[model samples]
Target: MEATFVIVGGGIAGVSCAETLAFFEPDKSIILLSESSLIKTVINLHAITRTLTQFNIQEMESSEFSLKHPNITVIHDTLVEINDGEHYILTSTNKTIKYEYLCLCTGAQPKLIPQAELFEEIIGIRDTDSVEIFLQKINRAKKVAIVGNGGIASELAYKIKNTQVHWIIKDKHISATFVEPGAAEFFLSSLNKDVQEEQVTKRMRYQEEYSHRSGAALGPDWYKNLIIKGAGDLNIPSEIKIHYETEISNIQRSNNSPYALEVTLSNGDKFTCDMIISATGVTARKSFVSKNELELSNTGEIKVNEFMQTNLQNVYAAGDVCCANWKLAKHWFQMKLWTQARQMGSYAAKAMVGHLNNEEVLQDFCFEMFAHSTKLFGYKVILLGLFNGQKLGTNYEILIRMTKGLEYIKFVLEDNKLQGAVLIGDTDLEEMAENLILNQIDLSPYGDDILNPDIDIEDYFD
Candidate 1:
């Protein structure tokens, strides 16, 4: 087997790269290989700003890749070995495929804590199958212990009902991955509130049998319509007890206790729960490729330059598998999110096409600023640039405006210039805020009036 381009992985990054290449260079042949039959495809793309984008991911059949692009072929196979010297790859089924250019998008896997004996008791949610397993376990669980404070942990903290939730975090506040201390405080109020009935929105749902092979990470609204209730059928409001500045020190099954297992925390607190969820985080999946073949970061991520090319000629990597080895823009930073995966994949395709054609390629504008939109506790959340004043030390000023349960808006300013912002709820300030940060417009003349409720910020910026 042979092709002009061979892409490994069927996640958002690999799909986006293949589609972009097929569209730009229709005469060239492209092949995509995946371990699973389901592939992630982004749809309903809306560019909210130059750098901000909103999109939904659809889990499509792997065959759809070739159906959509005649120049591309999709194969359901796992890459077992890569011979970089000869530009050939060996599949698990003993098939060898040669390619002139190869883009690796194998993505990352959940970084669970080292617990070899308790693997069955600890579950890490990453894909639809993992979520299904979690739901099955929760159905019989009266209480569960959740570890980590990222997006997944935060979402589960709000979504899971009827179960006594013991949320363990190593931070001073909750949802520390996305927001600052003040925003975390604002969200803390909603933990014990009643779960309000939300209006259902029309969206496509894809169902398939769970496979042992790891699939792509679940997308936005992954828990939208899922039944997240636990076994305990209490009429009272949901209970969530947050243990800040704590982590699991030890976990083991208890023979005498009523609960299934006993967990000891680093803070010397112990609790018994029916289940334990480890959302600790993810690490790069680079074992397939030999360490002697390419250079990798200390964290085990493949190192890629500005053009997304690795040290090896004609080899590139994108998505969570690769770390940005170039000097990033002031506002742009790397987060292993779906949005960055799509952007990097598309940009990598352009770079590859340009290199093949002996043409010069420029850096993508999306890398100029960091922007992300997501839902947190039923509220629309938008993060832009250095929203939490990251890397700015203590030389930054913060202005905030909150309207009870309606909205919470915050701006991070350095030298009277907008450096970042956080908009929670329907604040309708993302576009203007993004422009202010990108253009580096000084807001000093407005003083504190920038966040004044009476002022029409959008109109003023216009």
Candidate 2:
């Protein structure tokens, strides 16, 4: 008659799920298992989003969460294996525990992108340790090269001022992940703060006004000799070099030079460098669970119903593990973000308790369209709902409002509802904007407020 719930992982999803479960069923026992002792510190790429006041406030510091939850037991051990049957789970530490329910919030791993081996070899920046090593290498580096096409690459291109940057992007254009073409242009323009727009008019195709700030511009020949290759390989020298979308085929020590290490690329390409860091994205980490433990999506994420219940009965999953159909991006599911995982954890816990009560629950406890926003280096990037453009139909009304280098706001209005937006630089109306997106509020009042920044229109949504 023990109603004990076993939660795996100590990240935001796992912690939040434990909190929710503790709240719903105070009489039931709750235990949280984590690989790291840093129970509160979840590996978040968008840590700035947590700092921003526009979103939900994080209650406990990463280190203090377990101390706050007296009812939640925490075990700091690596989850090397999981054998989740109907009533129990075997831990990596050789401990067996009985549970009425199991929650899988064990996040993801860094994806070893095939062609990104060179990038990983020279300037990888994949994690905290890698970023530290990269910074150390940069301090001593005369020139730096970047690979990949995302916010991290964009920020790296803008941040490292003294070092010469050779950015190799597979795509001809800028980040196609969050921003649209027009907004992408604006963001690209912001990178070239050292150069004026008219001075680089020939490359104007890459220069779109980012905000009213006046100086951001995507520099000239900054990414020259930009090789467009598919699934390339990366080879590294003893010094520093990064190859994009490439894999390391072979590695060996130099015969003549004692300090030199030689590497071969998958595509027969070779390069030598001081250090390598991989900014390659994260992988959905389910390696511990036996392949037959649960059904997995193509992306390696756990397949779950609307209630966050995994294919394995009583095994609930939230966060990066659960499939997410983002409302703003209009894409089905993607990994490598903390926002969806946090919401999914809360929803999963709620649904689990609801089932215990034999009560009806919402189809999905969380919203379909998840929003994420963060500041990479200095540039502000916001992703609302979904972006894949599949759910809202082919045709939708789009209004783009901008002020060069200072502000950029693109509103996706469909059926008179503010579907989604990506805001940058100026965030005066950020909270109101998010409220509108979440509630799908009528857009008439905020229309004038957007143009006239001086208006104190508190009743816009009211």
Candidate 3:
């Protein structure tokens, strides 16, 4: 089969790239190759700020998508080989695909615990099938151990009920992945509070028989439909025990013990649990091989230039499979986020279209600032550029205003200019915070009054 554009994977990046290509070049034929039957699509997107956006994710059958877009053909097949020299790829089923422009959006796989392979009972926090498998395991589990502190583990800790969660992290506090310690402290209280149970967002989910191959990594509200509970009564909230500054050092089968496995920690503590969910993180997936292959970053991801093009001619990569190799913007850095995936994918399509039309495509303005919106512990969270004071060295100062059970706001400032911000809860300051970071206006005159509760911050801006 031949197409003007051939995209790989069915995750957010691949889908976004394919859709964008179809929209721009309606007459051009596009083929999307995937291993799974379902494809993830973003819906109900609301931009909280110019750059910060929130969206609900839906996983639907790939066939449904192709029927809607007659110009785009969706092929359910795994990419196995690449021949950049001939601008073609080979799938697992021996289907030969020739393309004018090719994009590899092959997502990442879970970076499981080092000892994961030795165990027959460990589950890597992954796609719907695995998560469903996890739920089935936890259904009979009285105690569950989660081995990661990233978004997936944190969310699992909050959502799972009627079980004892031993959350092992190498960091000092919970959710070190997204927030600083101060913000972590602010959210600490809500960790156990079951005030107004989190209502699951209803969505389509495939059963265990959906397809043995794991579908794309899930996105926003992927667990909403899953009522994750343990062997205990559903009314009882899940209990979380944090073992900070520690990691799993070893795993061994219990010797006729009731619990299935015994996990030894790096700090020399041992615990028994029915199952271990390794949310350790993800490593870029690179199962397919090319004749010359593609240039990779130090982190084993495809290195893409400012235009998302790889070293190989007419080949590009995006999302978790690729890393940005260009000089990053002051406020922007790479994180393997669904939002970034969407942004990179869209920009990649623009770059490809511009290349074909011989038009100049300036860097997207979204790159000028980093923004993300998410929900944690039932609180709205918005992160804006350099939120952690990253890359600023020790020259930056932090300003914070936090109210217990209400909101927590932190600002990273350098040279009297706003650099980044972390806004937890509905502070309604994302727009102002985003503007300040982008404009880089001096806030010295306002001094500490800028965050004063009495003064309306928006009034000064107006």
Residues 116-169, model 3: lDDT tens digits: 888767889777678767878989998989988888988888887788889999
Q: What is the C-alpha RMSD of each candidate to the true structure, in Å?
A: 2.1, 10.7, 2.6
Residue ranges of candidate 2 with Cα displaced over 4 Å: 1-3, 41-65, 115-127, 192-273, 325-335, 363-368, 387-390, 415-417, 431-462
Q: Compared with the true structure, what per-residue lDDT tens digits does model 2 show for residues 45-84? A: 2323222213222323334765666667777655555455
TM-score of 2: 0.71
- TM-scores for all predictions: 0.96, 0.71, 0.95
TM-score of predicted structure 1: 0.96
Q: Candidate 2 local accuracy as lDDT? A: 0.56
What residue pairs are clashing in model 1? Answer: none
lDDT, model 2, position 314: 83
lDDT of 1 by residue, 1-462 (tens): 999999998888999999899989999999999877877776777776777776666666767757778888888998888888888998889999999999999899898867624658688988767988888999988889899999899989998999999999999999999998888988988877766775332222223345665767775677876878888877856688899999888888878987888888999999899988888889987758542478889998899999999998798999999999999999989999878988999999999999999999999998988888787776778999999998689999999999877889999999999999999988888889999999999898999999999988788787
User: Scored by Cα lDDT, where does model 1 land?
Assistant: 0.85
lDDT rank, highest first? 1, 3, 2
Candidates' lDDT values, in order? 0.85, 0.56, 0.85
By lDDT, the best candidate is 1
Q: If both were scored by lDDT, which would come out higher, candidate 1 or candidate 2?
A: 1
